[model samples]
Target: MDIWISKIGYYFLNVGIVLVYGLLLGAFIAKTMARVQGRIGIPIYQPFIDILKTFTKRQAISHGIMFNLGPAFRLAGGLGTLAFIPVIYGNEMFSNFSAAGDLLLVMYFIFFGQLGMALGSGESGHPYAAMGIGRGLAQMTAYEVPFTLAVVAIFIQYDTSSITEIVAAQQGSIWNWTLFTNPLAVIAAMIAFLGMAAYPPFDVAMAPNEIPIGPPTEFHSHFLSMMQMNRAIFAGAKLILFMNLFFGGATGLIELVFKTWAIYMVAILVGAAFPRFRTEQAVRFFLGVPMLIGIASVLYIQYWAQ
Candidate 1:
C-alpha cells in the first residue's frame, strides 16, 4: 500500500507539472496569437477560469454523450502521455515508465490523443465541426510521414526510443542536444511540431475563415471551456515531450520550464510571422520541405552521425 501511494504520488507530481505547464504555455499562444491580430487578449488564468465556470454550469448543450465526455477523456489522454514521457528531474522517481524500443511509443501516444480529439469532435454533430475534425486528421496524415522519419533519425542515434534512455543519453551540456548533433532533425521536428500544435501557416484545422473555428466550432459555453483548457494543456505537454526527445530533460524544474517556454515562443513567433496556409496548400507544404528534412535527418544519423 505504501508502495502504491508512493507510485501514485510520483505520478501526481508529473501530472501537476505537465498540466500547469500546459496551461501557461497555452496562454502564451493565446496572447501571442491575439497580439498578431492586434487585439488585446485574456489573462493567462483565463483558461482556468473558463474551466471553473464550465464545471459549475449546467452541462446541457453538447449534442452527443461523447461530446460531453470528450473533454474528460481528452484530459485523461493528455495526462496519460506524461506517464510515457519523462522530464529529466523526474526520471529516477518515475523510473522505467517511459521504457520502449523505438520512436513508436512517442508517436503512438500522440496519435492516440489526436484520435480521441477527432472522435469526440465528430460526436458533436456539427457540420463545420466535422470539417475541422477532417482537416485535423488529414493534416495528421500529411505530416506524419516526415514526423516518422525524424523519429527514425533519433532512433538511429540512441539505437533506442525509450524516453528515459533518450534523456539519459543526452545528459550534460547543451551541445549534447540532438538539435545540435542532428541539425536536420531540429528543422524537421520544428515543422512537425508546428503542424502538431495547429499554429498559423498550418492552422488549417481551426482556420477561422475556412470553417468557422474548425473542429472546435460547435463548442461553446462550458463544453467549449473544457476543450479550451485541455487544448492549452495538450500543446504544452507536447512541447515538453519534444524537448525531452532532443534536449533529454533538464537538471532542474526552472531549466526545464524555461527551455520549454523558449520552444513555445519559437512556434508562436513563426505563427505570427506567417499567414495561414490554405488547407490543401498546407498539406502539400508539410509533405514537401518538412518531409525532406526528416529524410535528410535519417540519412545523416544512420549513415554518418554515428
Candidate 2:
C-alpha cells in the first residue's frame, strides 16, 4: 500500500513538472514567432491564466452527454499515455509504470484520445465539426503510415518492444542514439512529427482560418480548458517519447528539458518557414517522401543494420 502511494505521489509530481514545462514551451514558441513577425505575442503565463479563467467560468452550453465527455476522454488519453512511459530513464521515481510493449500501448492511447474527441464532436451536430473530423482523421491516417513504419524500423533495430530497454540501449554514448544509429527512421519519424505537432503546411485539420478551429469548435469553457491542459501534457509526453526513441534518453530533468526543447525547435522553425498545405496536399506529402523514407528505414534495418 505504501509503495503504491509513493508511486502515485511520484506520478503526480511527474505530471505537474511536465505540465508546466509544456505550457512554458508553447508560450516560448508563440513569443518567438511573434517577435520574429514584429508582434509582442502572448505572455509566457497566458496559458495558465486562460486555463484558470475557463475553469472558473460557467459552461452554460452543452451539445449532449458525449460532448460533455469529450474533453475528459482527451485528458484521460494524455494521462494514460504518460502513465506508461518512463520519463527519466534511470530514475524509478520518474519512470512511471513502463513495461514490455509500452511503446505499443502509448501509440494506442495517442489514437484513442483523438477518436474520443471525434465522437464527442460528432455528437455536437456541428457541420464544421464533422468536416474537421473527416479531414483530421484522414491526415492522421496518412501520417500514421510513416510514423508506424518508423516505429517498426526502430523495433526491428532495437529488437525489443520495451521503451525502457530502448532508452537503455542508447545510454552508452551520443553516437549510440538512434539519430545516428538509424538516421533513416529518424528522418521518417521527424517528418511525421511535423504533422503530429500540427504546425504550418500540415495543420489543415485545425486551420483557424479555414475550419474555425476544427473538432473542438463547439467546446468552450471547462471543456476547452481540459483539452488545452491535455494538449500541453500530450505534447510534452510525445517529446519525451521521441527523445527516448531517437535521441539518448535523459538521465536528469535538466537534460530532459534541454533535449526535448531542442527537438521542439525543429517543428517551430519549420512552421515559421513554411505555408499551410491544403488537406489533400498535406495527406499526399506524408504519403510520398516520408512514406518512402519509412519504408527504406525498415528495409535498411532488415538487410543492413548491425
Pick the lDDT winner: 2
The lDDT, on a scale of 0 to 1, for candidate 2 is 0.92
* Per-residue lDDT over 144-164 for candidate 1, one digit per residue giving the tens place of the 0 to 100 score: 878788888888888887876
The TM-score, computed over Cα atoms with residue i paired to residue i, of candidate 2 is 0.97
lDDT of each: 0.75, 0.92
- The CA lDDT at 303 in model 2 is 96
Candidate whose TM-score is highest: 2
Clash count per candidate = 1, 0
The digit string of per-residue lDDT tens for model 2 on 49-82 reads 9999988887559989999998899999999999
